[model samples]
Target: MPRAAIEANERMNLRVAAQQKATLMRAAALVHADLTEFVTRAALREAEAVIKSAERIEVSERDFLRILELLDNPPPPNEKLRAAIAALPRDR
Candidate 1:
């Protein structure tokens, strides 16, 4: 979604300690932004970072090679796995 669209239609309310509010206001001033804009931008940036970290998988080269090798030379399914597959419901 576009930033403008995201910002245009949302309302949020927050409460903070005086010191925290002062700090944020000061930082916002230094960046020449209103308090709401500064807080929104900072919150959005952190939110995106958190979501990206959660959604990403980081694998080392050795592990990647190992995964590929496993795929290429997979072991035969064991009895338990075969039983699980057999237990699965058939599609209509």
Candidate 2:
């Protein structure tokens, strides 16, 4: 696909060594996707995991207590959070 085919999403080029490229190409072909599509999907999957891990979440005593409380008596819905989740992509 060309630049014009891509939507208004943030994008950039990435590089890997020649040997790595050859290895990835073989893997991609085995899975029935071209090099570009294979690499892009793999990289973005890892990027999402990294972003999730970077979120500020701690497992301290207070956090554990809050979790126990929630498990004991779950809270009602927050409309804002529900709307945010509903807006996410369903195509996976």
Candidate 3:
């Protein structure tokens, strides 16, 4: 199945000093890239790290079956889980 395009809900607006901007331009010049290309490449590298850290782990076939078995017969809720749930902030 194909997935539909999804728009992001958040945006960031960064501010920097003139000196910093000059330094960035110089670095971009050294790399023969425009400011937009340099900024995008740097942002994309950080974004890749963020995405890798946030993703769920893939399991082996045997481990996946074990996970399914656990889901079929889930353990009773522990006190720690109950406390954690209570401590969590309510979503709007």
Candidate 4:
């Protein structure tokens, strides 16, 4: 979505060292971007990366094969499992 189309009613404040602020300003100028735009993009990129890392599951190759094997040849349901299945609504 274009920036103009989005409502900007929220505010975020940050504090940084003088040198860090100067560096950010210089980098923004070098890229011909507004400081807010550059910082927002960088922060958003990092946020997405952090979210992806947190949500993703990373299993070893051996564990992955074991998971697939269990799926393909699951054990027979025991008494508790059978009861749970029987409790489900049949009209679905």
Q: Give the top-scoring candidate (lDDT).
A: 1
Work out the TM-score per prediction.
0.78, 0.51, 0.48, 0.65
Clashing residue pairs, backbone N/CA/C < 3 A, model 1: none
Off by over 4 Å in 4: 1-8, 75-92
* Model 3: residues with Cα > 4 Å off, grouped in runs: 1-13, 56-92
Name every residue pair that clashes in candidate 4. none
Q: Which ten residues in a row have the lowest lDDT in candidate 3?
A: 1-10
lDDT of 4 at 39: 98
lDDT of each prediction vs. the true structure?
0.91, 0.85, 0.85, 0.91
| Candidate 2 residue lDDT tens string, 2-92 | 1236658766666789999899999999999998899889988997787777774669998899999999999886999899889999997
**Stretches of model 1 off by over 4 angstroms after superposition:** 1-9
Instruction: Output the better candidate (3/4) by TM-score.
Output: 4
lDDT against true structure, model 3: 0.85
Per-residue lDDT over 1-92 for candidate 4, one digit per residue giving the tens place of the 0 to 100 score: 21235448777789999999999999999999999999999999997898888788899999999999999999899999999999999998
Q: Of the candidates shown, which would achieve the greatest TM-score relative to the real structure? A: 1
The per-residue C-alpha lDDT of model 3 at residue 67 equals 95
